[model samples]
Target: MNDRGNASARLIAPLATLATVLLSIAGAAPLRAQGGAPPFDVPAWAFPTAPPPRPGTVPVVPDSVTRHTVPNSTRHYTRKQVGNAFDIPDWFPRQHPPMPAPVQYGVRPEGRACGFCHLPDGQGRPENGTLAGLPVEYTVRQLRAMREGTRGSANPAASPNPMIAVARGFSDDEVRIAARYYARLQLTRRNIVREVAQVPTTRVAGLLYALDGTGREPIDGRLLEVPESIERHDLRDPWVRYTTYVPTGSLTRGRRLATQGPAGPTTSCGACHGPQLLGTGDVPPIAGRAPSNILRQLINFRTRARRDSTAASMYPVVDSLTIHDMVALAAYVGSLPPSRTPRK
Candidate 1:
């Protein structure tokens, strides 16, 4: 019995030593792999990572988004391609109304009619913005933006020949004539305001109204401010641009969304734009402007069709907004004041 016990102890001693050595090696392996720190000792959130640069690929740095430049002056001439001008056919409208010739200008020259780019009845093509049923002041402000170069042409590569070129050449009187023409034209029933009731109180802008749970006053009666801040971001020389007016209630709704909303994934308007809804740096103004244009732009952003620097900034914000929010916001912005022409 004593001799058997001695043999078992001898065997157990060496085996125990071997097991400890193996355990030591196993424990040390992770530390060695991680350059001295044990695998478990590393921070819970720490990820094993290397610098972004790879052997053959260059590292990429994101560019800062900027507002599009607005032009100061424009050159005009009779376009040679009258047929090529923007044209809207009668079939485009779900319901077409009889449009009288613009009373102020008599008849638009061969290529000078609203339908030229916006199509015959103002169903604008995707390439160009729509102009159907836009308020007179809103249309005027946009024309002025084009004339002054504040609003740039959508196609950058097109060079000197672009939408801005067409707008820049238009005289002030011509702009007014066009504004009046479109303002008088009745909007298609299909284009009638939807989501009017769905608009939330939180989305309405200054001096809350029925839309925002305030006074039940109709929009047509109130004097609204133009969204110069949005224009400022979109235009180059905001000082030189003209202002327009929209319904007070609509502008109020626009202001709420533009100024306040979600954070983190979605940013507030004041975060990128300045306080008071004026744009920061190159960001455009949104306080007072045309609702139709604003709605069109928001739609463009949502669809990823209008991808300029300024629009890109709005991508995150717009993505978070519901369709109802978008409509309410647009209605609000369209009601603001136009750029007050400065006194010379």
Candidate 2:
């Protein structure tokens, strides 16, 4: 291996063991979950388990006969066209570079189009993490981990995890293509994050929360991530905005936990995620992502569900965090603006 490669390898080994000895000395108390599970337990709000799809929720409509339109969108798509997973919804294709075949259209047969759920812009929704401006190498590694079963949800048995099936279906070349496409896709905007004590009542609407007209209720110390307009979001409008209502004082607590740590300075998130929590080298940036996704990853790391090499390095840092701590960290990090410049 080249000298630089050797240096890089040397650098990585220590990170996996980062703050381990010091953290062991700290010996944090076990945090209890709402259901009396471990500290890393999946919080209901962050990973809001969607109800099972009703048998007749979606009414049958003629594909070509029905026309669908979203706000500010001049283009129209038929019911069949929108339902076709192979044909992604690109509401504003001019805003981004042309997506590679793998991104614009999924690898045939088993693979689903990359843009379908993530959106054509790669901005993604609250259920998944952002893909835009990600390091290609890092994204590739993550995809590989999913394919090999090394990456997974902290709680998987309860809900369907599509990434595993999707990753398994992707050819390595296709993975690279999609990763490169998303990497080159610049971040256009940040999701709206607000810390509130009370939030609008919500209903489970297809793996995401949608505000119910039943009036406001206490946030109850969890993140309430919902789309500004569920109808627009369902239309796969890449420009659709989401409002994540975090617990009161979550941002301040999260910022403190990220910078100062629970006890003292030890492998702070910024150390690997960059000074502004953007990212460093092949490490994925955490800022401006969905707080739900961030919390899910933190739970995955702490629970040892995502066992990829880089995630192993997150053990010490994530282990120190409780659900509340992770919530604060995710809220603060998610509220920040993403890095505008590309990193090599």
Compare the candidates by TM-score and give the number of the best one: 2
**In model 2, which runs have C-alpha deviations exceeding 4 angstroms?**
1-39, 54-63, 341-344
Cα lDDT tens digits, model 1, 1-344, are 01112112221211224333443343311101111211111110101112234588974442334313334324211222222233322322333345434311223232244555554444343224445545566566665654443343211111222344555556667667666655544322111222232222211121111122333323222222222343332221223222322333444565576667533524766676555444444455554443444554664455333443334566677665654566567655444432233112
lDDT of 2 by residue, 103-174 (tens): 878977768988887877788877766888799999899988877656655543222366767777798889
**Ten residues in sequence with the least summed lDDT for candidate 1:** 40-49
Candidate 2 accuracy as TM-score = 0.83
Can you tell me which runs of candidate 1 are displaced by over 4 Å?
A: 1-255, 262-266, 339-344
Q: What lDDT, from 0 to 1, does candidate 2 have? A: 0.71
Q: List the residue pairs that clash in candidate 2.
A: none
Candidate-wise lDDT, in order:
0.38, 0.71
TM-score of each: 0.31, 0.83
Q: How high a TM-score does candidate 1 get? A: 0.31
